[model samples]
Target: MLHTDAPGNTRQNGRWSSIVLIVKMLLTVAWRNLLRNRRRSVIVFISIVVGITAVMFNDGLSIGMISQMLENSIGSHVSHIQIHAKGFNDNRVIQNNMATPSEVENVLRDTPGIAHWSPRVVSFGLLSSALNSSGGVIVGVDPEREQDVTTIRRSIVEGSYLTGAPREVVIARRLADKLQVGLGDKVVGMASALSGDVGSDLFRVTGIFETVSSEFDKAYMFTSIDNARSMLELEDRVLEYAVIVRDINEVEDIAASLRSKLGDEYEVLTYIDLLPILVSQVDMYQSMMYVVYLIIALAMIFGIINTMLMSVFERIQEFGVLMAIGMRVRRIFLMVLLEAGMLGVLGTAVGLLLGSGLLLLFSHIGIDFSIFSEGLTSFGVGAVIYPRLTPDTILNVLIIIPLTTVLGAVYPAVRAMRLQPVAAIRYV
Candidate 1:
């Protein structure tokens, strides 16, 4: 018999091997079985969809809410990056650090990967309007370019961005309200230098800017860096550096790179670093997302295991017949697993659709939490929460849903395959 067998056919024979063919056959069988019980398949589909929708939308909205607040906090006043005097971070007092606008501007303009650069001077002072005076912080910025980097463009509610060092300024809506001044009002900014030699005498109100973060919105005043320099008696110098980048994703990369390149002489800080609370918050959300996915995956696994067990009990004769017809018990077990896998695939698809739908809807209209702002004062989170969408979160759900379903079916599948042929065949 060996002598008669074709001599060079082994390589060709291996191409049509039993295991490969078995998988194909098993998948086909699983598909047929699934279609045989359309109602059950549909139930599993609905469960997966519900789970995914809740997870995706809840996370998305949560992200958006935080993103909105962060934008208001970071984007409006703080540029993406700030280079300051090495020891100045601990004491952000105005006099301790200074950079010349034109000097820094020349270096920044030539620096690759930067979008825009600005020299800013920050000071805490008393803002006196025509009739009333309110305490606030004064922020000196370039009027025209301020719009390019932040949410400031939409925040000017009453008048206009300061123009041409008009002694003109933009105050927060809260400060404007507290000061009882609207458009075309003059406010005095009073800040004394460390030696009491330099101080802000006065400024005219050009506009009132509104934002979700009342802290910055109420206290901040925008003026031309020139006007700010003049008022503070700071000629040709700035308190710190403000830089924007090409993308938000590159923040940490840029921060790290800047730290290395700029070295220890200057402190390079990202907008995220400037506000530690927000960075901590985003980290907390990410940690919680992991826990959520784990819980949801375990729950989904249980659902799948239960469904598969039910199917095994319901189809004992089918297994007996397969065994009786010479189909290996291992193949029978594998087929059951394939069925579970198929369910997972279908469920994942449905979940993604529902999750995407929820994301789209929330992205547009926003989730309003304005009614709860008073209570939220405790957490420092705004009352109206917005959910933002990102690819990482979406990818998480994509990886989890099917993995849960497949893992859940493992035990039940093994039990089904191990059934004694006589017992399974004798089931009444």
Candidate 2:
């Protein structure tokens, strides 16, 4: 019994050794086959590199563009969160203004995540200059607090931000151009007060600003809170309280906390809620990327299938010889698959290195599209975009490339496995 068990163990050990040897042999042969056809392999490799590089570059650009849009919109106007009187968003009437300014201020000041907060008196009115008139939103802000909450102060292209001087106003560059008004020019604004009286005021354009969003630049104007209160006939009432958080990503959490603490009298909204158009644009861009990736994958699939088919046909006699010398059909199939996988691995590695290097270089220098500045600004995107890459994108590429290669090699691998040794050898 002991002798018999010893013989069985020896046989099992030999079988394991043979499996390892077969795997090593298969890998070596696959490596050799890739090297044997230098030109063809290089052609396939280059195609894959080009495809991957294009994908990475386009993805990076899309991400950068979206990021810039969000940054501009948030920094320029939205802040991270906004607190408003219920129903104020739907109607711009003075009656819908925030009634408890002190309570809102207390909550903001007490909030741990709050970076800055500013109360604003917002109203819709017709702004008129000597040359032109347009309907726009007039926002009254606190100069010092507003500067902390937004980049409006920094965006001043000409003139200065509100100085609390009586009737001092800040207008956008586009509005200034259309109105044909320069710094110190007087502009008139007309609106209806909550008391059902026509309210009108004369404003001196003390500052001009340019922002990434053309719509915002053309449709908004600002003044000191004191001037707005006087013009709108309001007493210490604000339409909205805009709050900036330390981290933009934590805005929703902060908003939720504010909502619970402030009770139902005030409505708390994050930037995403305030800017639905921007949210929709981001979703649309992400959906479009899916289509783009699908197209790229299809292109890669076809190219790989063509290359693998050629490789299989070229190695027909060699495969037949192997089968004739006792190689199993499954091993033949596996070898073909291995070759395709090796190609994918090589191509993907080189592509990632090249693409990442290019992205890093461009991220610092940025890609300038100043020629399309007008169009880019219309979408609230900067003319110079700094490319970005996320870990999810890299993981997707790593998974997709190998899967694409395997799918492309399936038919060729099966064909190689199904070959009749005698017929294949004779035909070749």
RMSD to true structure for each model, in Å: 4.2, 3.3
Q: Which ten residues in a row have the lowest lDDT in candidate 2?
A: 4-13
TM-score of each: 0.87, 0.94
lDDT of 1 by residue, 1-428 (tens): 67656656453536558678879999999999888888987898788888888888878876776676566666776778888867777887767665545645565676667887667777777888777887788877766676676666577888877776668888888788889887877788888664466486667777787776756655777777777777777776678777888887887787777677665667888887787888788889878888888888888888888888988889987888888888888888789889988888887788888788778876777666778765443344456665666898778877888778878888888888888778899986
Residue pairs in clash, model 2: none
The residue pairs in collision within model 1 are 61-387, 63-388, 64-386, 64-387, 64-388, 65-386, 65-387, 369-383, 369-384
Q: Determine the C-alpha RMSD for candidate 1 after optimal superposition of all C-alphas.
A: 4.2
TM-score of 1: 0.87
lDDT (Cα, tens digit) per residue for candidate 2, span 1-428: 77876855674547889889888899899989999998988998888777777888888888889989998898888888988998787776888987669988988889988999999998888999988999888888998899998889999989888888899999998988888899999999988776778788999999999998897899889998888888888889999998989988788889999999989888888989988988898889888877887888888888878888999998888888999999999999989888888888888898888878888788889999999999999988868989888675677678787778777888899999999999888865
Off by over 4 Å in 2: 1-21
What's model 1's lDDT at 69? 57
- On a 0 to 100 scale, what is the lDDT of residue 73 in model 2? 91
Candidate with best TM-score: 2
- Window of ten residues with lowest summed lDDT in model 1: 374-383
